[model samples]
Target: MRIKTLLVALAALVVSSFAVAADYYVDITNRTGYTIYYMYVSPGKSKSWEEDVLGNDVLMNGDTQRVTLTGYTNPYFDIRLVDEDEDSYTFWNVDVSTQDIVVTLDHLD
Candidate 1:
């Protein structure tokens, strides 16, 4: 009976660990001539909020960087890339529910 209890507890612990959410990584590259001021990522179908602003150091030409998010549960995400000239390039309404926990971006401006 003790052995069975131990096995059950071990199984519970393993299942609990899997229940925890995962973190995701996003890589951004600056292909544009201008420097990017900031970027944002937010939850499903909601108006983009400033709180989600990812203050990446001014991304210059051919520069690349990565951002990590933990316990993100949004079905839809929006990315706004802002330039020094106040020009914003918006990648709107992306569904990431099925995407891997790790997200990598290349030259996504």
Candidate 2:
């Protein structure tokens, strides 16, 4: 009887471990003087830039925007930021799942 109970508990633990999913997030810090008018997030290896993740939003100087990324567990990503002057910077191969990400758009001069 005890052996059967132990087996059941072990099975439950295994199932729960598989169920565990860590929430992914990114916080972009705008340190540049210019207003960041758009933001884009895409898989590191993807050809397309995808949608504007910021969507009608602007990230200003000293502002921080935290976005929770769902449905993807990809370890790497490409992040892009566009300033008011329409200049864009694409930082590639950023390992999202492992990065303590605070992408500071420091300068565009």
Candidate 3:
């Protein structure tokens, strides 16, 4: 049964190898009429929003911004959008790993 055990181990190794996480590309779209001052993306497991993903530029109304994030432990991501009036909107546990995600900020009213 040594050969059988070896085959099972090899299979497990191959499966585990495929489990390695990949980078995720996300587009933040502003569907709201207000100008988006900043967009924050952080790992879902983290306690805080790290920083504004839009470094030098602001995501204006009706504008879309592309961001690439790497090395997340889980598939879930947390997003926060800040408007010009300092109003904040939070989206929790967004799944962005498997497919290209468009995080749209829409009018609350």
Candidate 4:
């Protein structure tokens, strides 16, 4: 019976760990002096960008948007933003779990 209890407890711990993986959100503030038409975020190890987080919406300059990144365990991400002039700005290997992300002209790649 003790062995069975220990196994159950271990299983519960593993399940809880997975449940808390990347189950958080962060705010993305736009300070680049342009309208952001598209935004993409992918895992740091990924080779391509994920779907647009804006989804037909626009983030004008001086605006902030909350981006929820749930179900992903990876803390590092690659963020890309497209402006009204079709200019692309990329920020690589950003830790999106600890704090909000603020993008400005200085972030241009």
Which regions of candidate 2 deviate over 4 angstroms?
A: 1-22, 100-109
- Backbone Cα, N, C clashes tallied per candidate: 0, 0, 0, 0
- Give the number of the best model, judged by TM-score: 4
Ranking by TM-score: 4, 3, 2, 1
- Candidate 3 local lDDT, 1-109, one digit each (tens): 9999999999999998876677776777787677888888898888989899888788877778888888755777888888888877777788876544343444231
**Superposition error at 71 for model 3 (Å):** 2.7
Residue 58, model 2, lDDT:
90
Rank by lDDT, highest first.
4, 2, 3, 1
What are the models' TM-scores?
A: 0.59, 0.70, 0.74, 0.78
- Tell me the lDDT of candidate 3: 0.76
Candidate 1 residue pairs in clash (backbone atoms < 3 Å): none
Candidate 1, superposed: residue stretches over 4 Å from native: 1-20, 52-56, 95-109
Across 14-83, the per-residue lDDT of candidate 1 in tens digits comes to: 9877755666655666777777777777655676454535554576767876656568654456667777
Tens-place lDDT digits, model 4, residues 1-109: 9999999999999988774565667688999999999999888899999999999999999999998888888788888999998888888888877767899998876
- Whole-model lDDT, model 1: 0.62
Q: lDDT at 53 for candidate 3?
A: 87
Q: What are the runs in model 4 whose C-alpha is more than 4 Å off? A: 1-20
